[model samples]
Target: MLPNGDIVRQVLLGEKGVCETVSSDALVIDMSTIHPLQTDALIRELQEKGINMMDAPVGRTSVNAIDGTLLILAGGTDEQIARARPILMCMGNELVEAGGPGMGIRVKLINNYMSIALNALSSEAAVLCESLGLNLDVGAIKVMSGTAAGKGHFTTTWPGKVLKGDLSPAFMVDLALKDLRIAVDVARKTGAPLNMGIAAESYYAAASQDGKGRQDWSALLNQVRQQAGL
Candidate 1:
């Protein structure tokens, strides 16, 4: 809902009572990874108009989205969720009802925060290893095949690109940094001490500042490589 920003509003306004009238017929399940604050307002407004709404933001990746193997975190009423299950089942392998309106977004933010943070740390470590004269090379064949340690987005598809110095956008570094920034804001509000989150955000910040913002999150490794002169 919020992640799409004004886009959702445009849809609702465009359809002429679609947002208002559709509630009288079908359920509205929001899958955007928008701000938690915006989600709450949208849910409340739609619910008041007799709409059956659920915030079910997705996890996993583009590959998962295509494979229907995503992990779904949902927030809405039990009855509404029961109405949503049939739709959700087609899109995800695992679906957990997080809580009410905002929980789905909250969980999504934290999940992204952790993922982006880890990628930053992992890239830093890989670079650190290279700097220490650790044969970080891993042989051209292995690099061509990609490394298992890259994990998640880095899997077979991405690390090879990183190793070969191609920083295309599977998931934009700017977007990852945005999520991390939001997570840091959430942590501050909740009084959570997230030292790694802070550090991860900083690394991404520096990477983005260096003009790799539109590249893949894996581009963080470039910073490591530059520092190691590898």
Candidate 2:
């Protein structure tokens, strides 16, 4: 795997590159995390020259890589994936078929987007907890572990609420907004950098403006989807 799309392009399609060194029969597997559109374009270019290619971006960290237990997200035709499986298995223990051509990188991009952003949000929460004189382990971690705060909305609130089309206000958006404003106010007073919380406040504020304040907090997903015309 290379660092990014530009480097991958340089090594695979540039002067005296893989095209010159490898035969058309060689299957080029790209495990780099790159733009999905770039992955699609590269695959198309490779296929034009009768070269087989697959986007097989791996998941997990370097420790998993060293242990040969990474999760491989493979994007290619079934035949191509079958031919590439043994080679991929050498690097990863699990393989997920992420649809055709460029999907592996697409999934990887989405996963990283959520994870990287959440890292910042998590830091904001940690700092707020510290400023409140709460013990990080006993007060924050232990308390949030069983709730949506730590377990994540996807597995906690979402399934029973908006995902099921309920939106019946198990926790009202207005109440959530009120609580969020309080937290944001506290963070500011404590000199904590809660940028994520500030950004989230705007979304909840928008939801309230859209007359969704009485709806369940999970309905924010629907509000966002509607805003995106999705």
Candidate 3:
């Protein structure tokens, strides 16, 4: 319910805060979408005082909240989460135990990162479509909805390719870079800002330069993971 980590900290652990009144056996479930590190720190502080805590940030929209069908990304020990499940179910229908403490917020952060970034990317594409005189509804949305363009790489490309440990070129990285370059060029010429497209071109260009030109476009995930030492 709190806006950010600072407010949550002040209200929970600051001078004359509620932590002083909380019973040791009471479980504190933080439903805020704050920094994962902050969540971990708060949980540790509460645990030191013999107070159990769980992070259960909900997903979906306020509409889902009204319907009690939100997706709850929970993080805690199995026993701790089990004790909180019935209470959580009253709000969210789908409860995913993301991992141990701090993970719920981690997962939520990643989800939001992708979703929020894609929102801007999607807008860029829509503007490009307009600049190209393409019908946004029929020419773009209708076509993209059935393909990886709209359905997303996670469900389409990654599952069959990189996620399976197969990097064989279904759609080669070189070809992807080429296509992206074309789009970026056209967007620039049409006076449409394709900031996301331009940024994506850099990633594809690097993958190609790393001798992954023949690999599947999904291989970028593998390339990134390797770079991260994962």
Judging by lDDT against the true structure, name the best candidate. Answer: 2
Q: Name the runs in model 1 displaced over 4 angstroms.
A: 1-3, 13-17, 23-25, 137-230
Q: Measured by TM-score, how close is model 3 to the native structure?
A: 0.97
Off by over 4 Å in 3: none
lDDT of 3: 0.91
**Model 2 TM-score?**
0.95
Question: Judged by TM-score, which candidate is best?
Answer: 3
Q: Estimate the TM-score of every prediction.
A: 0.57, 0.95, 0.97
lDDT of 3 by residue, 68-134 (tens): 9999999999988999999999998899999998899999999999999989998999999999999
Ranking by TM-score: 3, 2, 1
**Deviation of model 1 at 53, angstroms:** 1.3
Q: How accurate is candidate 2 locally (lDDT)?
A: 0.92
Candidate 1 TM-score, true structure as reference: 0.57
* Per-residue lDDT over 1-230 for candidate 1, one digit per residue giving the tens place of the 0 to 100 score: 34484776566545664684574866787888888787787777777777766789999998998999999898888887788888898999999999976798899999999789776665554544454455665632246235434545445645567767787887788998998888567656655555777877888988889898998878888866766788
Candidate 1 overall lDDT versus native: 0.75
